[model samples]
Target: MILQRPGRLAITLAIIVSLFLLLPLLAVVPVSFTPKRFLSLPEGEWSLRHYRALVENPAWGAGLWLSIRIGLISAALATTLATLFSLGMWMLRPRFGGVLMGVALLPMVAPPVVSALTLYFFLITLGQANDLVAYDTLAGVALAHTVMIAPFAVVLISVALAQVDRRIDLAARAMGAGVARRIFQVILPNIRFGLVSAFFLTFVLSWEEIAVTLFITSVDAVTLPRLMWMGLRDNIDPAIAAISVLLIVLVTLVAVSRALHAAWRGRKAG
Candidate 1:
């Protein structure tokens, strides 16, 4: 089947909308290069002092390293749990699947503050018994992140699972493929892209998570976003603008590359 090509007017409108949405993000680029200490656009003079500070400042370096570490751990945990939950629902098609899904997606839909408070109280209680899950600890922050972002991973993996044929699973089962073998060899390979996407998505969510992190962490697990929030709240540092610019550029590059790849694949398929 042939698809209708977008009209020139439609394409023009899309470009305009994209640029408008990106305006705020683009504005940060100039501010990041400002010679001033505070957040401001570059004047006739420009400097990379703020960007340099990202490396030189011990707090920034520590926050960045901590964020990376927590992001990885939480992403792995969330992906593993999401994969298992999503695969179970897909295979079992249980009577309470809808209810289970709603419960799983609650974190995604609930207000950040609500989730944070819930996690905060839970961690506080858990920490009383287990130091590992105590408030202000790295493990606590990681667990909070995992809880907050797992819903997103579940949604993405479930969408991928929806596209998979049920008959394939039945065929594998009829051929005497055990649950473990079918999952590893059949299901996982088929959803490899989705799993990768979920991993990266959850990692990004954890990296940028500040609301819950703020509730669960203190000096012990100050993430990049938490540090940036502190900097913004205490003093409007240009260093935050530098970090924002870097993140914006990185995300834009990844989005563009993925779009190009998808278009190339579409053309090849056609």
Candidate 2:
């Protein structure tokens, strides 16, 4: 048996890259359990004082609540609008559809920092033009998130919509299905996977959003990421480390559970 040198080299390189990316994340696990006030691994003692702080501190809870609320709202808004737009574009198949698609995708390609600054100015102008509440508000933040997240949903759902057979639509039309009925009965059911995927993907994006959130929110609207950023500047408490560890554990469990479920489903299908 001859060993494949290239295959072995590629596997070795992949392992090195994975460890380099993941070792920093693992470091936080030990740092969180330290008895020390700052973020360092304990020599011999371990404590949950950092984790306890999250429960004891009202700010942490508020930040978490705010993040969830904003993430849900923004993600739903982005998914809904993107789904509608993608479906319309697919059905219409306009002559300038390519141009429209390019515009829809601009948010993702544009520089995030530049976009954040531009959005900040737009929010201020919008508030003043309406003679209503001016910038640094939840509404502003949500709007920013919606725009930032919509491009991803549009791209994903469009691919799914394209995969759908066009003959199904013609059959629905011949069967006397109205526009709305055809959409709900035919188009949506076919693309449910893409819709679900878009929602979860956008939700995760909004949950981890910090750049635009930082620019938009001023007071009483601090999201978890923003709070963590503030903590980094103001304090070095292991509570931040504890929070990091919690996030790491949750993500690991979710990924593992998803993989197991997929494998089980594959076995059943087989």
Candidate 3:
């Protein structure tokens, strides 16, 4: 068990790496409280001015709201489509599953610039360009996010479905259960964790997305990250740091909560 031991060298190396990764974030958190309008290491006085400004600014608030709404819509659409497709692939074991999965994964694997250009051209050709139905609309942004995140959902859900015992399906069939009943009563309950994980992963991906969003959206449908980009161009402010801190905290809380829930459930089952 020497490998498991907290040897001095290993502990020192771990701490060093952890601090290296976290230093920027740690620096940002305090800067978010700086009294100065510009970003800097905190000086004589720390203040909540930046946070207050973020909350009070209409443009920032609007962008935040739009991002949240679009992220939720995109996550839901991606999760539903991915879950259904993954389930179908599992049930049928069609030869095309490999091809379909590969196609679905293209959005994630391809360079963002290439995908954005292709999608832009495709949208324009379909007569969606510059119209409400075309680029820059909230719906359009959501659709793009859905395409980007669905493959991740499909991958996670497929792994979960693979873990399921095939005999369970046979048992349900032997009991004369219809498709709907079997899915809801047996399959869904067993794969609940997978579904939840897929939902969270897809949601987080959409929420944090920037590259494709940048190419595909404009002022009307601008998201939080887009707004942050604008802020970067105009000025460096503590508000941007505050927003980044908020996002990091939110994602951390979500991940910890999911882990705790899974642990509690396992304990209960035992």
Find the candidate with the highest lDDT and give its number: 1
Candidate 2 structure quality by residue, lDDT tens digits, 1-270: 997567888999999999999998898988888988777878998899989999999999998888888788889999999988998898889999999999999999998898889888888888887633347666667778999999999999999998999999989999999989989999999999999999999999999999887787777678899989888888776889899989999999999999999999999999
- Local lDDT at 25 for model 1: 80
**TM per candidate:** 0.92, 0.91, 0.88
- Cα RMSD to the true fold for all candidates: 1.9, 3.3, 2.9
Writing each residue's lDDT as its tens digit, candidate 3 over 1-270 gives 356768999999999999999887777898888888888877788899888888898888898899889889988999899888888888889987789888878888998899888766665555443565467878788888888899899889899999999899989989999888888898888999999889888888888888888888777888988899888888976799998888889878987998999999999999
lDDT of 1 by residue, 91-122 (tens): 88999999999999999999999999999999
Instruction: By TM-score, rank the candidates, best first.
Output: 1, 2, 3
lDDT of 1: 0.93
Full-model lDDT, candidate 2: 0.89
Q: Ten residues in a row with the worst lDDT in model 2? A: 130-139
Best by TM-score: 1
Q: Give me the displacement of residue 213 in model 1, in angstroms.
A: 1.1
Clashing pairs in 2: none
- After superposing candidate 2 on the true structure, give the runs of residues whose Cα lies further than 4 Å from its correct spot: 1-17, 129-134
